[model samples]
Target: MAYDLEEQEQIDVIKTWWKQNGNTVLLGVAVFVAIVAGIQGWRYYQHQQTTQAAGLYEAFQGAVEKHDVKNVRGIAGQLMEQYPRSAYASRAAFIAARSNYEGGDGKSAKAQFQWVIEHAKSDEIKDAARLQMAGVLLDEKNHEEALKLLDSKHGAGFDGLYADLRGDVLLASGKSDEARAAYQQALEKMDPSGGYRGLVQLKLDGLGG
Candidate 1:
C-alpha cells in the first residue's frame, strides 16, 4: 500500500538518521561483543588450568600408591615445572619432599623444602617447609643454619615447633639457660593434653628451672 504524505516524510527522516549514526552504533555494539568475548576467554583459560592441575595431582597420587619414589619425584617435578602457580604443584612438592626424606635422600628433600619455602603462595605451607628444613639441618648438626631458617617470621603458625626446635638447638650448643626458656615457651604454646607437654616439662626440670 502506498504511504500517505506524513508516513512518507517519517520514513525519509528515519533513513537520514541511520545514514548519519549507523557507523557509531555498529562500532559500539562491536566493542561490547569484544569485551564479553575476552571475559569468556579468560574464564575458559582458568578452567583449563584447573583441570590440568587436577590431572597432574591424580598422577602423583598414583605414583605414590605404587610406592615408586622415583616415579613420584619425576611426575611431581614436571607438575612443579609446568604448573608452579597452582596449589596442586605446591602440595606435590611437599609430598615429593616427604617421599625423598623417607627414602633416605636428604639432599632431594632439602631441595624440595627450599623450593616450597621460596615459591609457595600460602604462608602456612612456607612455615611448615621451614620447620621441616630446620629439623633436617639440625640432624646434620648445622645448628646455626637451622636457627637462621627457623628465625623466619612464622608468627603464631609455628610458635610451638619453633620454640621446641630452638630449645633443642640451644641444648646442643650447651646454652642451658636459653634452652630452658625455649622449652618453657614450647610447653606454653602446646596443647596441655599433648604428649610433648610432658617431654618439655621434663626437659625444663632437668635444666633446674
Candidate 2:
C-alpha cells in the first residue's frame, strides 16, 4: 500500500509540473517567432528604402549633368518629398537649392535650403544649408534675419565662414565696428593653412582694425 501511494504521488507531481510549464513553453515559442518576424520585417524595410534612394540618386545626378534647371528642380523636389529621410534626398535638396539660386529663383532657393537645414540627417548637410540660407537672406537684404542665422552656433567646423559672412552682412548694414569685430573673429578662427587667410587679411586691412 505504501509503494502504491508513492507511485500515485509521483504521477500527481508530474501532472502538476506539466500544467505549470506547458503554457510557459508555448509562450516562449510565440515570443521567439515574433522577434524573428520583426527582424525580417526591418530588413525588408531597409532594402526597400535603400533601393528607392539609389534610384533617386541616379536620377538626381543625371539631372544635374544635363543642366536643365527645370528638370533638376522638379526631380529633386520629388525625390526629397518621397524620401525625406534618405541621404539622397538631402543631397538633392542642396542641388536644387543651387539650381534655383542660379536660375534667379531666390524664393525657391530659400525654401530648399530651409528644408535641408530642418530635415537633413547629417550635421554637415545641415551646416551647408544654414550657410546657404543665410547667404540668400543677405542677398535679399534681410540683414537681421541673415545676422541671426550667421550668429547661430555652428560649432568649430563652421566658425570661420560663419563669422566672415556675418562681417559681410554687418558691413552691408553700415555697422563698421560690428563688422570689424566679426572679421577679426573670422581671422582668429581661420586655419593658417587655408586659402581664405589672405582674403580675410584683405578684409581686415579694409576695416582698418
Candidate 3:
C-alpha cells in the first residue's frame, strides 16, 4: 500500500512511541491480570472455608440435639481447632460449653467458655461466655472469681443481665446490701417489657427490696 507523506509521518510517530513504551504497557497489563486472578482465588478459598465450616456446624447441631455428648465434643473441638477463624467456631464453643456444663463436666465447660471469651470476634458472644463462666464459677463456690468475671464490661444489651448476675454473686457471697444495690441497677437497666425484668424483680424481692 502507498501512504501520503503526512500519513507516513503520523504512522512513524506511533511506531516510535510503541517501540519506546510497549514493554511497560505489557508489564502493567500482566500485573493487573495477576492481581485480578489472585483476588478471585482468594474469594474462592474463603467461600470454600465458609461452606465447610457451615457443614461442620450443622453436624454439631445434630449431635447436640440428639444428646450425643461424645460426638458433640469431637465435632465442636474440630471446628474450634481447624476453623477457628470461622463464625461457626465461636458458636461451636458456646454449644460445647453448655453441653459440658449440662453433662457435669464443669472443667471442660469452663475451658470452652474461656476459649469463646478469648477468641470470639463478636462482643455479644464474648459477653455471653463471660456471663456463663461466672455462673460456672458460682456453682463451684468460687464466689470472688465469679464476682470478678461479672465485674468486666459487657455489651450494652447485656448490661441488665450482667448486673443481675453480679447481684447473684454478691448474694452468694453474703453481701446483702451490695446485692440489693446491684439488683436495683439491674432493674433500672432492664427493659420494662422484657421477660427478664420480672425475673430481676423477683431477685430484688428475694433480697427484701
Candidate 4:
C-alpha cells in the first residue's frame, strides 16, 4: 500500500511539471515547424523565379536574332522588372545594348549599357558595360566623356582593355604622348599570351614607340 502511494505521488509530480512546461514546449515546436516551412517555400519560389527568368532570356535572344526590337525590349523589360537580380537580366541588357548600337540607336544603347553598369551583380559585366559605353561616346567624338567612363573602377583582368580605350581617346584628343603612355600601360598589363598583346604592340609600333 505504501509503495502504491509513493508511485501515485510521483505521477502527480509529473502531471504538475507537464502542466507548467507543456505550453512552452508546444510553442517551440510550432515555431520550428513554421521556420522550416518558410525556408522551403522561399527556396521553391526562388527556383520558379530562376526558371521563368531563363525562359524569358531565351525568348529575348530569339527576338534579338530576328531583329525584332519591339519584342526584345518587351521581354528584356519584363526580366529587368521582375528579376532584376537574375543573371539573365544583365545578359539581356547586354544583348539589347549591342543590337541597339549596331542598329544606329545610340541613345537606346547607352541607356541599356548604363542600366547594366548600375544594376549588374557581376563586376565583369559592369566593367564591360562601361567599356562599351565609352566606345559609344568615342564614336560620338565625346572624348572627355569616354575618358570619364574609362576612369571608373575596373577589375584587374580589364586593366589592359581599359588602358587601350584610354589610349584611343587620348589619341583622338591630340594627346599623342599621353596616348603612347596609355598604350604602353596596356601592353604591360595584358597577358603575355593574349591575342590583345599583339594588337597593343602593333598600336605602339604605329605610334613610333
* Highest TM-score against the true fold, candidate: 3
lDDT score, candidate 3: 0.94
Per-prediction TM-score to the true structure, in the order listed: 0.83, 0.88, 0.89, 0.88
As a whole number from 0 to 100, the lDDT of residue 20 in candidate 4 is 100
Whole-model lDDT per candidate = 0.90, 0.89, 0.94, 0.93
What is candidate 1's CA lDDT for residue 18? 90
lDDT of 3 by residue, 77-182 (tens): 9999989988899999998999999999999999999999989999899999999999999999999999898889887898898899899888988999999999
For model 1, residues 92-125, the per-residue Cα lDDT tens digits are 9998998988888999999999989888999988
Question: Candidate 2 — which residues are off by over 4 angstroms?
Answer: 1-15
Alpha carbon lDDT at 109, candidate 2: 93
lDDT of 2 by residue, 1-209 (tens): 35588899998998899898989989999999999999999999988998988887898798789897777888888878888888888899998998899889999999999999888989888888898899989899999999988877776889999999999999999999999998999989999899997898899799898
Lowest lDDT sum, 10 consecutive residues, model 2, at 1-10
Report the error of model 1 at residue 74, Å.
1.3
